[model samples]
Target chain A: MKLQHYIGGIEGLEPSSFEKKVFVQPWEERIFGIHVAMMGLSSHLEAVKSVPTKFNSFWTWGHLRQGAEGMNPFDYFKYRYYEKWLGGISGFFVESGYVTEEELSTKTEAYLVNLEAPLPSGGEPAIDAQIIEYLRVGDTPACDVEAQPKFKVGDTVTVRNPPPVDHCKLPGYLRTKKGVVDQVYEGTYNYYFPTGDGVGDPMPIYNVVFDSHDIWENITEPNTKIYVQIFEGYLEDPE
Target chain B: MTENVDRETYSAARVRALESLLIEKGIITGETVDKVIDFFEKDMGPFNGARIVAKAWVDPEFKERLLADTPSAIAELSFPRGMAGAEGENMAAVANTPEVHNLIVCTMCSCYPWPVLGLPPYWFKDPTFRARAIREPRKVLKEFGLDIDESKEVKVWDTSAQIRWFVLPERPDGTEGWTEEQLAAIVTPESMQGAAKVAVPA
Candidate 1:
């Protein structure tokens, strides 16, 4: 599908002081088309995870993206080629009901404000402000309030080897690096719905530092150091 | 004691009164105002570090020091103090190349290297660009109307609120013997982000 169709929905929102026109080129159009398609797939994934049906196309698409090694014709059809079309269908399912702008705004505001609300113990609470915002408008989660870190200044620990496959907050560049805990900063408990994980306060992640040479690999000077700070999810118990 | 109490109460009351007046006057627009105030409250508001990046690009020793010890490099500049809304001794800057340009996007949220590159542009904050930029950076750059030579590498930095990065563009051409001031003239925020390159216009 063409990229213009993705942003076609945003045209209706009353332009506010914050609104401005952003043009797209062909390459960008394709990228956005992919992104919007992903959003639709992610929403469907949530739906399928919560309530399974022969309408399990979202899970099938996610599995294909994961490249889950298994027998799968339906997976390829739902995710590999027709994902965007299906995603657009997912978008329609979401925007089906009548919801007022004020209600939407109120919901959006709540999501943005309490972005890091924690997950309930044992039970995954399906409904959240961020989810509501994501379903109604394609807005993703932003700065969270509850990401409080646990490691202390000067704690020598190693980053976790590989992040959890399903969902993660860690970036790939920082995986498996070692460093001193420079400082402990607070993080909020905002749930990133796409991956379906919760970031919160009580167990805030510290910014662990790794030397520059270790991170970049190409540094010629052994003494040449590039320090990188990482969150807790990226770290594991240093052996 | 009574006078002191009265003064305190009066100041508090005055602040509340002004807040109400602003809201009544539409001077304070809902959560947007709260966000602005919150931003100010958090020391790492956008523009603070940008000034430092602008200054460092000119100073060779500062650049050296920044590369050496980023926090200390930033401390060399005054604005490094009180960096709110982030973790660690937060200081980082990424250099751009002639062949490839760099731009930052907070796909998940507006996670920026505030100390180096100040506040994000309106477009940077837009969900449209933010979401698509990560999934397809080259495509996004093409949309910005940049036609990078295929041979030239295009590296896109996705700062996922885990760590912040700043892009330092290749110094503009025709600067064979130009001073830092002249060099800095073309090193705009856009140039640093790789969306645009630094070229001394003829």
Candidate 2:
């Protein structure tokens, strides 16, 4: 059976009426804060080539998502977003050789042994405030190459239905679906794959307009339109 | 409840382990982590978005520029110099009008305008919101307490790392003479996300 596009389907699940909140628990806040810190460190490590693992931003993100994918459905749904991040980063650290599996497992055991012990503190800072500021302000340069866009605005093109194993920008739901190109972003941008070998080829991005009815079966609102950004390589002439 | 506590403990311990390893490896230090957290908490957030929306509401020219070129117009204001960097690059602003309601989502992942809107709320990143927002946006908006007219069109922008999107919600009425500060006060992060409407003070 095709996966239901709407999360709870039409009749079975009731929409949540509970008050929407930013963070449900204190640990969530820590997760969010630490995720930021991890991202900053990852970027710094990538910059300095300090770690043996030479992954880019997208690779790190893909590894994080893959980690969540490994979890059981119950735990996956129950764990907060930052928890998923923690899991992903832990798995990534192990896979990248930055931290050993024994280290991760043993450290948790040590912490559990003395739960009341004061948290580890006091270390020479690697990224100073100025470095953090510079990193925060840094921008990735758009790919500068001369290339003709295969599809123009209003061209009907379908997303290639390739099962990409590594990091990719194309979403699963959009695969093999046809949409009209709404806007063409001329410049090619460098996107890294999960394989830390090197930066992948750059490609221009486009905004494709897909009708809600075309994408989903039970169309509640036919007038609704979903605009998704598609990379040039992902598009193909519709069969 | 025990399971929840165990998971949190495990997660926290993992972070601690990772931090220690990075520090030991000379990759990063605890102070670096604290500094990064401080930057997000103290330096950047939705306040910048509120300021931009308020400025647009008061200045017609700026509003036109914002809708036309978001990054340049945003740079016009006294926001940080890195407005075009990180999650802020290729930023696009879609205004909500009487005929069209704009909603932002990333069906693939949570791609939000971090520089302007700050960290996204948990629900914004939830799988339910990501899927249903495209399938049944009107129903989703209603859940957020926004009931749109049947005559209006709903446009959902599936944002990505390539182009980050934020909604320019229609300014609430009855605040014609209000200062930018007052207008900014009324704008919530949800309003900018188009999940909830901006309301006038009673």
- Candidate 1 CAPRI level: incorrect
Tens-digit per-residue lDDT, A24-136, candidate 2: 55445544554554454455334534432222333334455546555565676675667777777667668878779988777767765554444455554434543464446
Quote the positional error of residue B152 for candidate 1 in Å. Answer: 4.1
Candidate 2 residues B13-132, lDDT tens each?
656666666656655554656666566666667888999999999998999999989989998898766677557767889899889999888766677887888778877877667767
Model 1, B1-202: lDDT tens digits are: 2234443233223223222222333322223223332333354443544455556666778877876566666666655344422232244566665654556655433445543454455566564665454434455566776666546555455554345666666655567776644555556556555566666778
Q: Give all candidates' CA lDDT scores.
A: 0.43, 0.69
Can you tell me which runs of candidate 2 are displaced by over 4 Å?
A1-22, A29-34, A43-59, A69-75, A113-117, A124-126, A129-131, A139-141, A194-200, B1-5
- List ranges where model 1 is wrong by over 4 Å: A1-230, A234-239, B1-55, B78-89, B98-100, B150-152, B176-179
Model 2 C-alpha lDDT versus the unseen true structure = 0.69
lDDT for model 1 comes to 0.43
lDDT of 1 by residue, A1-239 (tens): 21221221122222212222222221122222222223333534344254211122232222332332121424422331222322332233335432233443444344334433321122112222222223223222224455435567888877665524453455444456677776565453233334333332224446554553465554212222223345454567444
| CAPRI-style grade of the A/B interface in model 2 | acceptable
